[model samples]
Target: MDETVTAVIDDVVARAAAHDADEPDRLRRWRVLEPDAGRLLWFLVQSSGARDVVEIGTSHGVSTLWLADAVRSTGGHLSSVDADPDVQDAALANLVRAGLDAHVTFGTGDGGAALAGLDEQSVDLLFLDAERTEYPGWWPHPVRVLRPGGVLVVDNAFSHADEVAPLAALIDEHPGLTSTTVAVGKGELLALRSR
Candidate 1:
């Protein structure tokens, strides 16, 4: 990564770490994206020229805030979904703190159901970080919603490798998508829709 990109990732990590340490409740079950994960996410968004992004998990809004920042810089918009209302509220507050409220739209409820309501091929980027075991269930909807040449980023893919086998198989069999798994911050799978 370039120096400029490195600096941005550092800044984001610093902020997230500070906030995570301050809020014990928020840190309980939440695993905020580390610096490398954040950098990869930022790179993916920028490289894909993704304007309309969807995030499946919004725990404390750290990753949400990161995505919001990318969207704001790209003059894009982010639709973030979380099942927990409290986490959603925290995410909203974090975005506001980052001065990114205008770029993000929050949906609080069942992430799968919320995503199902979106139009097919409407999302340019999809970030999955919800229930680890239910990843396959939540995987297809985002895949269907992403336009050609869009990207799908699934977190914890390797950590829950056995559970996500079906998803891994789908990615392997599907000709329209190519996937790469990176072991960063609990492992992330990046699937790009073939052009």
Candidate 2:
């Protein structure tokens, strides 16, 4: 990432931290992927030369910005999903601030519904950072939409192991997927579908 993008990410993250501190009791305000995890997401998109990325969860656009940065380089576009209009607006503003808004399309309401609407084998990268328990029920779409060799990155694997275990076990049962749990920012459950 360039200095400009770096500065924007740092500023956004700091502002988000402040907001969380100020609004301690807010429910949805509790979930922003750690900076290291965000960077890893960025690197994966960049290195894979992934053009079609579908990201579930656009919390404050922190992760979306990182993904948008890579998509911009790859001449790709990102369709990011979030259920809250306010959060979507905040994410849109942040993307515009970073000059990455052109690389993204924002969807509001029912992320799972949005995800289910995708075409088969249409995605190059699928990033799951939404509800933990809801993941298992939402599994089939990613499995269908993600092309062979696509990367599936699930957030909060270790941090929310119990809640996300079913999805983890589901991945384990899929013979075509090779998986690993990496201890980087809330822990990521990374998997690659076989070709």
Name the candidate that leads on TM-score. Answer: 2
lDDT (tens digit, per residue) of candidate 1 on 1-195: 334434444565666677667676833655666656766787778877789999988876767767877877778999988888887886676666556789988888888897789898898999888776666676567678889989988887777777667777787777889999998877888888874
C-alpha positional error of residue 162 in candidate 1 after TM-score superposition, expressed in Å: 2.4
Write down the lDDT of every candidate, Cα atoms only: 0.77, 0.87
TM-score of 2: 0.95
* TM-score to native of every candidate shown: 0.83, 0.95
lDDT of 2 by residue, 71-139 (tens): 999999999998778988988888888899999998887767887899988999999888777888887
lDDT of 2 at 98: 87
Worst ten in a row by lDDT for model 2: 24-33
Q: Report the poorest 10 consecutive residues by lDDT, candidate 1.
A: 1-10
Tell me how many clashing residue pairs each candidate has. Answer: 0, 0
lDDT of 2 at 164: 76
Model 1's C-alpha root-mean-square deviation from the true structure amounts to 3.8
Candidate 2: residue 25 Cα off by (Å): 3.2
The positional error of residue 146 in candidate 2, measured at the CA in angstroms, is 0.6
